[model samples]
Target: MPFVLYAPVKDGLHDPSIAKQVTAFLSKLFQDDTTPGLHIEPINNAVDPKVRTGRVTQMYRAVLFKLVSDGVPHYVFTGVWPHDKAIEVASKAVLKMNPVNGLPELIMASEVDLTPVVERVARVPVASVAAEFPFLEYKSPGLTLAGLTEELGLDPDVAEHAWVATSEDEVMELAGKLGGWRGEALLELAVGATIADVRISLGMDTAPTVEAEAVEDEQLVSAMRTPTAQMQFAWLEDQEELRRVIEGGDLAAWRIFLHPEQRKYVEAAYGGSFRLSGGAGTGKTVVLLHRARMLAKRNPQARILLTTYTRNLADGMKRSLRDLDPSLVLADAPGKPGIYVAGVDQAASQVLGSASRDELAAAVEAVLGIGGNRATSRTSSAQKAWRDAIESVGGDLGPELRSPTFFDAEYDSVVLAQHITTLDEFLRVRRPGRGVALGRLQRQAVWEVIRSYRSSAAVAGAVDFGEVCAIAAQLAASGPIADHVLVDEGQDLTPPRWQFLRAVVPEGPDDLFVAEDSQQRIYGQRVVLGRHGIKIVGRSRRLTLNYRTTAQVLRFATSVLAGENFVDLDDEATDDTGYRSARSGPVPIRVATGSITEELDRAAAQLAEWLAAGAARDGIGILVRDQRMVERVARGLEDRDVRVRQVSKSAATGKDPQLMTMHRAKGMEFTHVLIFGANADLLPAAYLLKDLPEEERADLLQRERSLFYVAATRARDELVVMWEGKASDFLDAFTAKDHVR
Candidate 1:
């Protein structure tokens, strides 16, 4: 026998708990009746025949008739109804199959009979029925009058009329008049009234029309109290479960999932230049990675060019892309046909080097005012004195001036000025009387040497890395490559690089993507790319969720970055649903009143303990404010038998404990981070005050704040920020504000 099961859309097997119970009940029913076949279906919407065609429906109809013709029992499991269109169709189909199988034995299996089919059948009195329905066992008796009305789909006044009645006869009379199984069930279950009272009240054996005036008054009062009634449906259980998931490291359960501002920023799809400025641990790199992945998904054919200031960063990004998607073909070298990743200066030099040496020399001379053979004539006596002074100095001028051949005009005037400045400063500091009193004479002598040297080499001019960018920009602007250019770390671009980008990219609007965080700017002399024609197309999007650190680590880091420019992450707990950290680590910050040696010992001890506790060696990083500090810390660690690898600006060839200057640590992650020398002089030194206007001071401070933010965020499980005696004033602000515990 085949049985069909139907449920109210609102009461269908959507809830897992309810579905489990229904499945169990049907299994038990089938176990006892081996001859009857049961079919279960949900009736949320009618099946569209177009989806399957006539052949499919005919097959089902034919199978059902064969079972009936063979004297096999079949059953339709569904809610009781009075005027159910589905039931009507089923009844007609069954009648055509066999005359003896009439009505298919109607069964009421749900708590409420809101269907209209019951009224068309005889109004069976409750007293006459000996067997109790299965649905009544699941129904709650505590359901309020209003709750019952909603659950049973009845007019409040009509429900109230039957609810107030007392006897079974009256309920049956009312059900008969109402003319439906839905009306019968409403009176029986919701009103708790018997059939006797329903029959007496209506003064008939059939269902009666409900009083319209009474229903209207009841509905008005119900409407006024709807909000309070609706509050009951909020379902605190579901809310508790959701909160548990979020607090248990399932971060995706939080409202908005990603930060709301971040979603808006990404959706804008701003084609022009857009910069995301934040401190180190603020998910800037994550946003960049996600943006790159998103762009690849959107425009698979468009080639992406990612250039960082250093080769390490470029390699890290390339490795990250591979980790993100193994299928994404990445070239080991930058000049590949797909996504190109390389150092910014390397890319500029490669592109510019294609030009002829004479053409390149002309461009360099135009910028630096070198060569052109327009030398100022000097007397023989002055020339003799210049040669005599150079011989007396006894220093190698070629190496100092960066000249390969003595008379080459390719030697830059800037290089000459740098050499003269170094010699002058050396004389002032070490040998005070030699050039101090003879200032103009000293300057004239330096110029005389430069002129004579240029005349010997026959070179017109030379261009350094900066000039290469400018020249390349001009070359790319006129060439076919100008249509698409993608720049990374665009915020740290110098004036020349900006000019170079402007020269290569076409005017009036170009497809440019700039990924940068202003807070990570360690160099005080650089210009933000946006200030030089890299128009910001939309608001900066923040990637607040720290995929790299725990809440405790992020808390201490954010505290250090307290400023107007810092965007705080949503404090909702971590999402630990999919992936979770195995061990909980302590928040890493230490105060040391001892000397530099003591600080290094304490930091190394902590690193050893972290490693002992199962942290990977590659996951450890040591960050310092400058290269001098890096060298000091590296030497100190080596003395203690710690194998420390110093990350050079030029190459990445070492292992952990990777010693990196804070400037180079941007866009990288470490499982355990030890920040050394957070003193005021090193962190926000007086050097940052040089050559800056008053208005730019605030910008510098913000940059400092961002630097600290970045340093703090580098840790995944443990973060140790330590400083010597008398730490930076910035530390006081964070500690006093209880930003770190």
Candidate 2:
């Protein structure tokens, strides 16, 4: 029997044929490494004599480094490639343990070429280059160049190559090519981490004493079992696990490679409610999924509700949870003792649908203060009732109060939030976030408007989703519905939805887990969880290290919110102070054209370029501001002979390039993203800001900025923003003289 450890690929493993071949190879290798079909032969003249290539198929091969541990044969499978490429990789690759961190790192010995780096540096003054590349500043007596080579275990040649880089981008390019811990270390240093900081980040404080230069390979094998090494390597114990990993590919890797910070949150036992906040791609949702699994595995009969703000995201989470662990039961109802995944609206519908007619009527009366036997149905537009109400009874209201937007915000944030069902209760409400204070007479007028709205909705037998949620909260408060509840995309959850979730699961140990980022709150208003009965004051954590988006993309995404102040669920203002990225890639591309047609043409051309460069159509996304633009862009792309499918309430099913509105793109990621129609009039959508008080207008603009940030951060590797005429004011952050600073 042989021991096999699999290394994850940074880019996803998407080729079905290659995946099948890798699966076959791993199965055979686990059976017997000496099997002739595997062709596990050592490379001739390799950097490490133990480096070898195993046959995957006639045309493909797997790169492995052979080792012996406790007299048992062990093989570390790095990746699979074409036969020639595998041979080349095997010739140059070596597995060595980092002295500072005591973690095994795989690096190519023959990858660096000093000639081009030195030539690039010669064009600029050495002092200027040194200042531009922070890695060059690690020349202190405590952390000297010699320390980088000897103490830190960096290859002398590679260290010199990085030190002579002329710019941060140049070093990033080098990091991309190096592709391992060496690249990771160089990236951290280039983005302003001291050598000592890198060590600490890698858990060097607990450095083991495994000697790197031990004559026997057993010591090197021992180093692979270290905590830091486990982050990058995982042992495949059986054929079933290997097959699952081979099939799951990148997602399987995500399940295995959680950072220490994320692992802490996932594994921690909380006394009550907890909140996890981070920017997009900071692994907040990842932690949620892992935590759900941990809780389920700990108690097999626990009834958990894994939910989010929308149906599409919730559906996606259910699928991902199945992938993470298939044996965990999935329940359709609340009390079935399994993870029930649903959007908040769906959950509310389930709760309401299960109630008796009398119970349902009482619940509706509790929320709306009216009696009707008509079952609630989804409305074409929740705003339509408000518009009708304002038209019929809002005659005496001032100009500002005439808008349906004003009524919607006031009703949800104040009326529904405080459970106000009477004229006097509405009049006496504080209306904290209402921007403009209302007089007693004005409050009476608003109550009349609300009454009219409720009457009309009752006559039509249609209730808005928010009302459904409020009714569900009332119905569920009679008894516990779930043992535990987990919320993703929590910032976009409104107060009623929060109340419903709180009522679904009683307050107790590990009762509620919410993952949110205030900067991505593109849909709902700012909600304070404490006000909604789910307190997270003492049980909150923020994850600042982004693992999904590259540093270049992260910087551009974050710049959109550079000066805007955002509040977490606790209502405390938050900052992105310690936020950073674990990887680096090319800067985002920005294009401004004279007309929408030209913008569409340029976007189509960029798509062609990416396709020609081997990008997958399924991995590309074109995000727009509105559903109309989504359809228009899909038509335009079709006219240009590009395959595109418009995404609405569900995840795009096929592999054709997805065209979605910015709001629809939430909780989704892509390899390359093109945010289209980011023009001056389109992004804030003109209508949202047309007729509003100054405070409301400012708040709406902040939400729009958050929407843009969410869309921009979806791209994992590349981002391109296309606009007609002038770009959105949000892009001004990238245009100012000191923008890059």
Candidate 3:
């Protein structure tokens, strides 16, 4: 294992130019790599006597371990800290190298107490579970500390940590807090999780450790030498990649490190449709982009379509894909493509011809058998529009029949999205989540409104966007033009959109690769994928580790979705279990102010604090609920002499810290995010709750909460949630959980 100096630590060096010093040292140390040239000097009173220190500058120190690994001298740079902190880190007397990942970590020798495990070793039996409420095992003893250590494949230093603890409770607590694969498995067992096969499923069963007396097999030697994550030590194969990493500083680590979970999905091959779904920030999109590139490299001539639900996200993907590999053929503009990077609507227009709302309006006028200029389509719900169509034709409409919003939900969310065409289909459609009772007569009245609208559209020759996508799907199913189609943010696309995607590429091995998480679906649309001809029963995978956001923010975001259930495209319950983050940061700052002015003042203060802490202006985001606040916040920032920019959906990419709505905040991440004006009425939109029943409004409220969750996760380091005038009711759930009974 050649020592890998992380690129990120360069940013904190006493001198920025110290990166060059470290680079030159690494270049020489890894010159022969196998036989080492020694510059590493021992730090007195180091945690593990084997660990040594390397010089970066006067103020910064590098803690590394030089060991004869797998019969070859290898150097592993474990960490970079300021001089004092570096000494403290090195003073942690024990080093625990993960057998599975081949990464070395340190814990203070004094931190662990082995008396609990050593004393109780024979008295307690650690089985998967006890038959009678497991009470006996919790209070009693388990197997020997040494015996447990051997089964978990832990090294001597790590094993010593448990031997010092005397209580079974302490042993279990250690497992929960331990950071490696070994502890992960032990924690699972302690919690009574039924792991099917430890060796294959969990990867806790690993190669022999260095402290072991004998190398059990010939293969174990090579396995021990190679690190799974590039973030750890690996023989640097490309000097240019190394140089780029050094020059770019910290962000370079993101390009190099692939967590074990992400690596699994990125490198896997399948014989049929495949999907990767998980909680937000779990790196599903990372795998999607990587897998797409891998396939492109394997088949250079193959045509690939990288698609998503929105133009903004698609554009973002295009930028990231270019960064991943610039030479790969990819779409440049919306329709001008080498290989397509497009939104579903854009793709549909490319294949089935574009239809503007105006054209559709004209077509509807023709269907209405009218010759005058077509009436302009006002922004309104589909149900209201249907009602208007009937009224325009002088049709009698009863009171119950006038529930335009409810019927409109039926049409837009169910009918058009599902591509339901016939009256019989409409009658049979079960709107399970509609939250309003509609009897046979009511259904008939709604059907009459829809029927009249469709007839008028037919007479006027109007075709809506739904028909455009249906046609695109039909055309795509006819032949295979693109060799592979990859989708990101698959959660937000409607059913017909998914059908169109399924049709765009002929079903085959490696044909369609999708990454999604239903919990992040801000649009509040759900589609059963199997019904749309996409089968992923055994082909779907969920990633649990979140690498993007801090654990503090992730916990709050997760709690927002707690007690709610979401479905994947295939109608399967989307699982968010085991989703976690290793990075820890400050708890989100929650502010409850009595007025908007006070909320803005507090938010501005927080932003100023973050800016003072060295955050880039663009890395901060102030997400609001609407355009009025967008303007108000911009003026407020101006008043405080903080340069600001208001970013609209039309112009999202910028260097200035952005001010936008939560809806516009999707597909974006910032280091510091301030979400304000999340008052219940504004977030769910007053229109959704105007006349809706409590049951119907509840569903919308959940979406509002989910929208906040998305905004919360955008913060990589810090999140601040603020509301004026008693705070949004959404805070009630978390408050109840946090308060003592």
Write model 1 residue lDDT over 342-400, tens digit each, in one string: 66766667665566766655554554345442212232233343344445442544333
Residue 511 CA displacement from its true place in model 2, Å: 2.2
| Tens-digit lDDT track of model 3 for 686-739 | 766665555566666667778888888898988888887655665655653332
Ranking by TM-score: 2, 3, 1
lDDT of each: 0.46, 0.80, 0.63
Best by lDDT: 2
Tell me which of candidates 1 and 2 scores higher on lDDT. Answer: 2
> C-alpha displacement of 575 in model 2, angstroms?
2.4
lDDT, model 1:
0.46
TM-score attained by model 3: 0.75
**Segments of candidate 1 deviating more than 4 angstroms:** 1-271, 290-301, 326-336, 369-462, 480-482, 507-510, 525-531, 537-540, 561-588, 649-655, 686-705, 736-741
lDDT of 3: 0.63
Superior candidate under TM-score, 1 versus 3: 3
Error of 3 at 73 (Å): 9.7
